[model samples]
Target: MKIKAIAAAFAATVLTPFAMAEDQSDWALVIHGGAGVIERGQMTAEREAEYRAAMHAALDRGEAVLEAGGSALDAIEAVIHGMEDDPLFNAGRGAVFTAAGRNELDASIMDGATLNAGAVAGVTQVRHPISLARAVMERSRHVMLQGEGAETFAIEQGIEMVPPAWFFTERRWASMTRSLERLGLDLPERPEGAPELQGVDHGTLERDEREHRFGTVGVVALDSDGNIAAGTSTGGTTAKRWGRVGDSPILGAGTYASNASCGVSATGTGEYFIRLTVASRICALVEFQGLNLQDASDQVIQDELTAMGGDGGIVALTPSGEIAWSYNTPGMYRARQTAGGDPVVGIYGDED
Candidate 1:
């Protein structure tokens, strides 16, 4: 009897912690600021700390909702709202200026449970384009609204609107100026007249591409109810012309989710992502080929996109609380938190 009782107590002791851990949470969340050529040499410790804090704050926003039994869509959207308000990332306030010396923002959100999505492109007046995207998903019959029409829909929905100048920051303005100078063009005086975006010469796109760098913000989440969602937001490419829009506002390119597959949110060169359908392709691999989330993402980012010389990455999550990511560039600004794990944020390849 003594030996039996001792064995039972041992079993209880081993199982108690596991039970507690399992009960702590069943949800997971991941986010990415952007991915491309980030190096330790480029950032000071203080700046890296700030990026870490910003990512943690965004994670907290989503984790709080998931822990409180909210849906995946609600949690991911809330996290993106935090990112859009911060100037350190390129989504809303910090969006890059176009060749026309204006800011055009794009955003999209998807619900995995229903595969329903909404997006907005070339919207200059909306304060938080993600929320406007949600409003489109829930309120409108259309899947996407673009340009001035998107703005009109946003205003009619009573969403908070901001002036176009509200998106301008000194940093972005400087970037615009630098881009123009690289192409041997003069910077246009903002608020005075439109920029001379026409006939800017050819070798400029490669130069402008190097100057603008890359940035977009994205999130993927798994809720307590086993539902999933994904979202992405961005200021279009720097010095872009003719109302150029990126993958951020495209449902399958920047964001995709499916309860049967996985939720994927990508950050990279928007043009490449658009051509590849990066997000949905990852989900499709999971759903059709029966690969796990990590394997599917790895195959896509490492094999397919890499073959095309694309540089980018994705933060992907499965409904069962699995987290996975892949990037071909030097690094990817990424973070992830699971049911019983603390948050982990990384800016470089080695950090993960």
Candidate 2:
């Protein structure tokens, strides 16, 4: 081809028109349901459609907040609350059962403007743990509260409380049983009045099984005011033992935000995330190393995590509204919306 023809081809790709949402809006947002072995071949059409719809709803909800001139922290809080209400992903209503046959939730939130953050862990009463996390950040001096103490603070703050049974769902219960069986955990005897349980195959653990034990839901957003924020919540690993609290509530592990660099929310095996300080590490890469948002996110999720025998993903946003995400797994439930385009949501590796 002639030089002019090649130049024209490149221009065409660069100058393609997009469906803009607002004229003066200068904001962006992205959310993730989780990252695991979510392959298209293994998902039924109905299931895929369900996930896509949920992701779109989350993106739109958060984008609406930003378009209305809401704070980036508000957008992330609202987006994460909606996912926690939906029983589809393991965060709020769909949290997995622990080895003790009960629900224990963990959540965290961050404000990039002042490095303010709050976290709550092993709280079973709060319907929206993210809100409790924000309360801890804004209402108190502490960065984290755990178990009954967190619940007490939430109750004191007049946060809406739910019964433990409210989070019980058939899907999460089944996943818990399967994980227990794989780990050879002996269950209590089936009583005469109890229903007979059916055996289920939860699928393969694959390489890095220890680090890919479960999934989490999270969000990162940038507002018109140039502030960034991030939040994360999780039901935790299925059949998790000994009151274990994953990185979801850890400020520098599964969630971090910084106006000086970027905001990040992580999902996957929480232990590995904590060990490597994944979320803060990305921000450090951007702030200290002068890497762009995309480069830092890719360096952490794609290269570092994978090399460490961990599998997961993250969504990140810079102060300038640049967005990026990376994952080594087959799929990550993710979506993004900005002023210049409509929402884009995907689940499988091919979609990425």
Candidate 3:
């Protein structure tokens, strides 16, 4: 009888690990385009459908990577690359213009397992700033690079560079001109070969105001190996002046990830996000405050950020495979998908 009891105990021990592994999450991903004053009646049906399609495309790219056993870092990079190329969301090609009529981009990426991160700012000629940010994290001992120095580094790494004109779009140019006029600031010269503007439609401009007020693109992912990663890319703000830099390239402010905590990527008013260290704060809440990813996101964005008059939102993923996002704005372009699951998307605050 004693021998039989010992054998049963050993069997239980052997099966325990397998049970835990079965319960563990395989992989998960989340993404966000910008967030602000978006409301139901503000956007035309055609425009809203386009945004939904774009979100789905970004999700497909990231889902493919995670499903293929790729690292969390790789999954997020793939997602951001698609958005940066899509003219619908402001990041790379669709970046909003600064007061000086130049498109100065910024981006950052983080590795949760290693706590390694990289960032770049004011990169005018690089075609894909997110790639440059990763190169900074991998190639150099530095965490951040900027402006002329960043462009030089891109050249050394053989990343694609395009003329500043490549970033120009008629809608962005018109937005900048209107903003400058509102602030009584002088307009800068148009980019070479820019199309002549008759007049931007008032409805179109209003829709864009809500959508692009805090324009940025970001992604966070948890992979099959239980690692997490987060990244963000942006063009600062429209009509920004004097070499302004937003939170997008600041590690803890705009982007943060940790295997022990959660990965976070934020889009909103840069100054407010920077002041609160929004991304890191959200993770800290989950790690130390004993809150889940969803509640932690709410505390920072819906409660604290809103109290401070800040507007924006964030996408987050925990090591255990929880995906969450919270925005004080009326709408934010976002989506999520888990391994072997169909993509789920949300735009308005009412979505689950």
Candidate 4:
């Protein structure tokens, strides 16, 4: 009789902690607006303020969702929607022009709880590629779609569509022209019906804005239900050609999430991120190698990615509400917020 009583008490002790852990109100969200050689000297004070304000607005959007018990997927998608509309970041409207003088965007989304994912690449007309990616995950059997086919799918799914000209930004066009000139290639003709460049003072990209040509925007979140979700969006690299698809639309490369491991959204040199599987590789280190989120991120970004000569960074969130980020570049535009905690934003590498 005593043995039975003791067994019952032991079982209760072990099970109680798990139940409490499940009920904890822990939630977190992390976001990044590209990474590169961003130094204080290169950024004007006005430009810096604009970036910080955008990050704060994004955090507020996501925080409201999580605080209201929204799913991690919804929270991140909401945050990314605002960034996609804002020309301050390079995802949707401000996307860089390709070698063909077109804006070919790519994006991916993953739900950690189910391991379901979707992606779209080389999409030109979708207003929000991230939303299309999510639609693919929920409504289609395929994992990825690209180009005209993806646009057709977006239309069939009632995803918002925009004229290609709507994506044209003078800054991105100037950057593309300069890139082509440097490559000693013939300049591309402007797309049909492109709006005339207006209110642009400089024809050439400033040093600080040079890296903006390679920017991407991403988000990773862990909700109160302990589900993790990650999403990434980009306009590939400036002057990309041959229907090039970067890591942003590739699952397990630039974007990955698994409730058993971690959620990751990466921005960097797409080829290197694709080769190293940077996103999932970091999560693998955490789940399989028993490394904490920070150590796993460091190992993947600082050690392995650096050895491969990759330049960029990643933001990761664990089911346990841990947030981590690592970058090999001079700086990464990043932000984070947890339930009941203040939002913290960073741009320069020197910041903690």
lDDT of 4 by residue, 1-352 (tens): 0001111111234322111233455678899999988887787788899999999999999999988999999998899999888887889998988898999999999999999999999999999999999999999999999999999999999999999988888878887887899899899898887887665545226664555645899999988888999999998898888988889999999999999999999999899999999999999998999987878888989999999998899999888766788888888889987765567889888885
**TM-scores for the candidates:** 0.87, 0.87, 0.92, 0.92
Q: List, residue by residue over 288-327, the lDDT tens digit for candidate 3.
A: 9998777888899989999999989998888876678888
lDDT of 3: 0.86
The C-alpha stretches of model 3 lying farther than 4 A from their native spots are 1-22, 196-199
When 2 and 3 are scored with TM-score, the better candidate is 3
**Per-residue C-alpha lDDT of model 2 across residues 84-189, encoded as one tens digit per residue:** 9998778888888888777899999999999999999999979999999999999999999999999999999999998877887755666666677878997533
**In candidate 3, which residue pairs clash?**
none
| Whole-model Cα lDDT of every candidate shown, in order | 0.79, 0.81, 0.86, 0.86
lDDT of 1 by residue, 1-352 (tens): 0001111111334322112223323788889988766776666578678888999999899989988999888997899998888877788987888887888999999999998999999898898999999999999998899989999999999988988877876667767777788778767668333333344333433432342366789999888778889999889777888788888889888899998888999988888888999999999999899987777888888888888888788988877666788888787778877655567777878765
- The TM-score that candidate 2 achieves is 0.87
Which parts of model 2 have CA positions greater than 4 angstroms off?
Answer: 1-25, 188-213
Which order, best to worst by TM-score? 3, 4, 2, 1
| Candidate 4: stretches off by over 4 Å | 1-23, 199-204
Candidate 1 clashing pairs, residues 3+ apart or interchain: none
